[model samples]
Target chain A: MLEAAGTPQEIEGRSLWRDARIRLFRNKAAVGSMIILGIITLMAIFAPMLSPFEYDQIDWGYIQEGPNWENGHIFGTDGNGRDLFIRILYGARVSLAVGLLATSVSLVIGVTYGAVAGYFGGKIDTIMMRFVDVLYSLPFMFFVIMLMVVFGRNIFLIFIALGAVEWLTMARIVRGQTLSIRRREFIEAAHATGVSNFKIIFRHVIPNVLGPVIVYMTLTIPQVILTESFLSFLGLGVQEPLTSWGVLISEGAKVIEASTWMLIYPATFLALTLFCFNFIGDGLRDALDPKDR
Target chain B: MNAIGKKKAVPILSVRDLKVHFTLSGTGLFGKERKLKAVDGINFDLFPGETLGIVGESGCGKSTLGRAILQLIPPTDGQVIWLGRDIVGAPHSAMQPLRRDLQIIFQDPLASLNPRMTIGEIIAEPLVTHKADLGKEEIKARVKRMMARVGLLPQMINRYPHEFSGGQCQRIGIARAMILEPKLIICDEPVSALDVSIQAQIVNLLQELQREFDLSLIFISHDLSIVRHICHRILVLYLGNVMELADRDSIYAAPKHPYTKALISAVPIPDPEIERNKERIVLTGDLPSPTNPPSGCVFRTRCPFAKDVCATDIPTVDTINDHHQVACHFHERM
Candidate 1:
């Protein structure tokens, strides 16, 4: 009876990560998304070594050729008859690069901006939040389009545009978290310790706010990736010779009747990429969440 | 104002007429700037190796005074003299070196320790910031030693704050404060968030640490019982004004101020016989707003002993004894 009583108590006292992993692993969609995302990351990382055909290599005679797995064109040919599989691999690299870089840039700027606003509070917070609101009200897509029009199509430009547009949400989330965190005794304790403002902000304030920032960052990546893809599809991102899932899908859509394989393969990859990101994000949302734990 | 030759003992920390006012902007149609006197001309002294308890209800500016003493919030008007140096108007750069000497242990143990930092990192933070010369091994050993001193197991040093209980977390906070070996520790309700049993343990721990280190402490709380237990002297505050300042036994045995009397009478004694025999003094109305405080004496609105003179002039602090002081017109007559 003693052993039986102790067993349930021990189970209840399990580690937070154990509980988080249980919930995350149980999410089939999230798990499936993880697998797909992992595979895409691996493909992107090892694209050069793995792909048989050169990404930039072209075949004029077989431009827009359909898939023939036996002939080694497993995902068919693109507009330049470049192996679609290789192109997709390279495109994965670009998408992941833009997504990660843009998210990071926004995270840095937004976290700093929001943390300051929330920690100081009062008029400073009001003024900073108003600025965020003003930015939020503006037509984000139109601004991105104008930037693209002015700067012309460049790979880095896409990252910049996405980062600039995506940071507002991150800033708002960080600010809200910081506002609540600043009220906590630890922050006040830090202040009372005579710790400098810089140290308090970086050491005490930033660490407490990281959980929410990380969760939001995970969610933000998919949005940024989607936006980059959309821009690329519109010919304002990842220009010629440098392909992306969006560029490939856009090319495939234009001549779907002649080469259905082009549309099918790129579209499938794009869908799978999105599905993976959303799934991993959901899994992370559950896993990292202190409340759920 | 005479020097009062007895005051030359040189208080470790002296605060004179400390005032912290926040300007509240008007919200609606007719906006007016209203100044909220959080800490209104409060004066007190903390001697070396003595625990000074500042007790008041929430929003009475006890916490604000603690912060103002540390210069965490720039006081609107006041002089916070620590070791003869006025820290109130000191530059941030000038105060950096002094920070290591003056540390604080906050009320909520869980909220006070950085949740993201491991126990070792949290304790070692001050050392790293102030004494950067210490090697990694020395820092680790020091943190481990401090943790052991605080009665926590060495292996638990890698764990985050959330993993520990409230009492244990408070111990971590104490460890963090004491690791610096600060001259003055401002404990802002350190044990108020713990269980009754835990409160005793923390209070005992603080007393032990105080005696062991010969440290001066500013113990701020609303619990009169706990304050009486740990403090050498107690300063009763009402609406950002000092109502009474006396030795622990004197204040508890014969509180001169009406506010102090009301506060002591309200603390429920655990023993049924003693509790039944004790006269309960309940003040009639709610505490007046500090934004628009009573004209002369802040406590006049709540005082049962209030008379015409109580409203016209703020009573000065009259010496009842060498160390005891009471700010009430009737204290002399009584």
Candidate 2:
């Protein structure tokens, strides 16, 4: 309409993703959490290597000592003679892995399963959703204990079990999302173009539903970590020599009166990490919508 | 890419008694089920390069008819004869080849486009799906070309649909529909969602594209004024039934059916003198629920001069002159 419409160089194109990312960075709490998470993750990886005492190494010199610099045990030794700092670092690796990998496993399974069920409505949707409902009714911890009993306490199996259990909710969320998305005009437009149903589900349906799926995924990671911790408390998680925050916390909780630092250190790390994830989740939910989701 | 051959004798699209009925199941245990006849037995023939306007009220099934013809919503019965082949019950594989020649432009311009996809990907989707052998460069070139043709700047091809205004989004929709160079495009109220100023631009763009590509269009809308611009012939539908079908000028000047007359009268003239003096025949009462539509004639309940006979026997379409058909019992007397 106007000849002086902004020149190509003047008119910069901004994608929704770039805008969301910019907004996400602008949130002070989310940015602070991200920086803290990055620092913690880096410390978790490198801090253990720099420590003089091995995570499992027992020093008969400083047994049940309070946090004192004379011993070079900054976080102090536990009821055992091992350094608390190195063990917490080791715990960080296990907990973060369980959180991320388990959540990824669930995301893959849930997104595909839900998208297929919702796209192919009618009998297929009913049967698939009913199956999900059946899974939902199962006792989560009881079956998880059973898997541990049968599989001999493999940490990988814990991931699979937690992921499998966690995906029921993800599948339900994705299915509900897909149900609404399939009726959207874009999906019909895809059909009008003669795109195969298979292509439609993967390309058109899944990508649009990913916003909610991603928000749900951020929240699910913390839940998965907490579950792993609970399992460890029950003595079914990572075995001896390989410790997690859960293992550290359970060990520390028993002798809290004699040594409160052991409980406080792991508990602080756990709470801070979980809060970071929750805050990040809230920021993403806001940023993704940008129009007040 | 389209090779235009004007076949005056044979129609490009022949929708013969096409009906798309939906059965709504009961909500509770004792709730009664009912049939909603959205598009009940509509007949029309669209010749090559001609524009057929379908104007009706909100629930008169204008959209259902457009989707039915494109097989977007599969028809319940009757034939959608395209190029001498009935596509009503055609399988997906069989329809894929035919889809290249048939396309539709949706009403909500922004909603019709995938938010995740760029304008280039959205417009190139049909080409990528139908033309399997096209290289990436070739497809991109074709997409850009189509974009330019639809009055969109080629530089904006990579932008998302949300980045564009309603008029620009409709242009993107048109580029997508026209990229395959389809023979017939069912524009399902394509401009209804745009601003009034933008509506004229979109309509003009559509007309320009139609002329250049030799495209036949079945333009459907609830607004009769918008349909009057580009349509060669116009059809009047009341409650999924065609009340009248005639040339655009005849329907506007001397409408035979009362429903058509009311619709025509509702269209405001631009001049203040003519608009103020025009006798507007405003129909009372809302469109009846399609589940329990009137038995004999769908329009009889709403008709101003409805004789007792209008409610007993259904009025079949009567041919008044060359291709001018009216479905009213008192058309001759009126």
lDDT (10s digit) by residue, model 1, range A1-293: 02222222111223445556787888898888888788889988998887678899986766888877776777878877789989989988998898899999999999999999988898999999999999889897788878878987788888887888788888888898888888787777666556677888999888767767877887788788888888888888887898888888888889889888887887788777777777777777777684764
lDDT of 2 by residue, A141-238 (tens): 88998998887989899889999998989998999999998998889988998999999998899998988899899899889989999999889999
- Report every candidate's CA lDDT: 0.84, 0.89
Residue A73 of model 1, lDDT score: 74
| Candidate 1: tens digits of C-alpha lDDT, residues B1-334 | 1113325567988899999999999889898989999988888887878889999999999988888888888899989999998988898788888988898888878878776777788898888878889999999889877877877776676777878899999999999998888999989998888999999989998888888888889999999999988988899888888888988888898889888999999999999999999999899988899889998788888888889988999999888887689999999654
Cα error of candidate 2 at position A190, Å: 0.9
Listed in order, the DockQ scores are: 0.33, 0.55
Q: In model 1, where do residues sit more than 4 Å from their true spots?
A: A1-28, A47-66, A78-82, A120-152, A257-259, B1-8
Docking class of 2: medium
Candidate 1's displacement at residue B119, Å, is 0.9
Give lDDT tens digits, candidate 2, residues B256-289: 9999989889888899999999999999899999
Which pairs of residues collide in model 1? A186-B111, A186-B112
Off by over 4 Å in 2: A1-12, B1-8
| Fraction of native contacts (fnat) of each candidate | 0.37, 0.54
